[model samples]
Target: MALLITDECINCDVCEPACPNEAISEGDDIYVIDPDLCTECVGHFDEPQCVVICPVDCIPHDPNHVETESDLMSKYKRITGK
Candidate 1:
């Protein structure tokens, strides 16, 4: 599944650099996770890097974009050649 940033974000800019997929980006006032790029760190890390580095716990799974591990793995492979 993709990760979405909630309004509770503290805007500390911590999660931005943590995303291995380069999915997270700074929005107008908070950070936003691009669904197209967010793979929940499936192919890169055992855990989601943004969720770990977020200070306010603003990151949450995007139910609208439910995806299986295999789907994410496919996406990761397509994006990074891994």
Candidate 2:
């Protein structure tokens, strides 16, 4: 599943750079994660980098974007041009 940044985000500005997929960005009121670009860091690391670094722990699985690990890997591959 893709990760989502809830309204709890404080716009700490840390998640954007930590996303290998560049999925995180500053929204009108908070940070937001693009589901299409999110892979939960499956192909890049053991865990989601944003989740590891998020101070507010606002990042969570996007129920609307639920997908299998294979789907995540496919996304990662597409993102990296692999």
Candidate 3:
């Protein structure tokens, strides 16, 4: 599943660079995760890099965009064209 950044985010600007898929970006008020591009780092890392580096621990699974591990891998492949 894609991750969601809640209002608790402090905008530390760490998560944006940590996202391997480049899915995180600055929104009007906080960082937002693009579900279409988010792969939870399945193809690049053992865990989500953004989640690991976020200081506020505000990143959480996006309930509206729930997806299985296989789905994420497919997304990763599509993104990398591999």
Candidate 4:
């Protein structure tokens, strides 16, 4: 599943560059993850980079964008063409 940044985010600017898929961005109030591009770092790393580097623990799996490991891998391949 893609990760979501909650309202607890502090706009710390750490997660954006950590994302291998460039799914994280500055939102109006907090960082937002683009589900269409987010792969939870499936093909890029063992864990979600944004989640790993998030200081406030605001990142969480998105229930609305639920996906399996296979699904995340597929999305990663599609985005990276690898």
Candidate 5:
């Protein structure tokens, strides 16, 4: 499943660069994740870089955008052409 930045985000700017898929970006009030491009790092790493690097632990799975591991892998392939 894609990850979402919660309101707890401090806008620390660490997550944007950590994302291999470039799924994170600066929003008006906080960083936002592009669910279409987010694969939870399935193709890039064993864990989501943003979640691992987050200082405030604001990154979490989006329940509204629920997806299985297979689904995440598919998204990763589509994003990376791998």
Candidate 6:
């Protein structure tokens, strides 16, 4: 599953660069995670970088956007051109 940023984010910009998939971005207020591009670091890292860097703990699993490991790998391949 992909992780999402909640409205509780403080826009501190700490989690943006930490994302291995570059999924996190500045929103109207809190940062937003692009579900289509998010891979939960399946093929890139051992864990979600955004979650590790987020100070407010706003990033959480997106239940509505559940995806399998294969799907996440395919998305990662598409994003990185790997």
TM-score of each: 0.95, 0.97, 0.98, 0.98, 0.97, 0.91
lDDT value for candidate 1? Answer: 0.91
Give the range of the ten consecutive residues with the poorest summed lDDT in model 6.
21-30
All predictions: root-mean-square deviation over Cα? Answer: 0.8, 0.6, 0.5, 0.5, 0.6, 1.0
Worst-scoring 10-residue span by lDDT in model 3: 13-22
Q: Which residue window of length 10 is worst by lDDT in model 4? A: 22-31
- The residue pairs that clash in candidate 1, if any, are none
Task: Indicate whether candidate 1 or candidate 2 has the larger TM-score.
Answer: 2
lDDT (Cα, tens digit) per residue for candidate 6, span 1-82: 8889988888898888988878888888778999988999989887888888777888899998999999999999999999
- Model 1, position 71, has a per-residue lDDT of 93
| Angstrom error at residue 3, model 3 | 0.5
lDDT of 2 by residue, 4-80 (tens): 99999888899999999999888889988999999999999999999999999999899999999999999999999
lDDT for each residue of candidate 3 in 1-82, tens digit (9 for 90 to 100)? 9999999999999999998889999999999999999999999999999999999899999999999999999999999998
Ordered by lDDT, highest first, the candidates read: 3, 5, 2, 4, 1, 6
Q: Model 6 scores what on Cα lDDT?
A: 0.88
Q: What's the lDDT for residue 5 in model 5?
A: 99
lDDT of 1 by residue, 1-82 (tens): 9999999988888888899999999899888999989999998899999998877777889999999999999999988987
TM-score of 2: 0.97
User: Poorest 10 consecutive residues of model 2 by lDDT?
Assistant: 24-33
Model 5 stretches astray by more than 4 angstroms: none
Error of 6 at 43 (Å): 1.1
lDDT of 5 at 29: 98
Tell me the spans in candidate 2 whose CA falls farther than 4 Å from its real position.
none
Cα deviation of 43 in candidate 3 (Å)? 0.4
Q: Model 4: runs farther than 4 Å from truth?
A: none
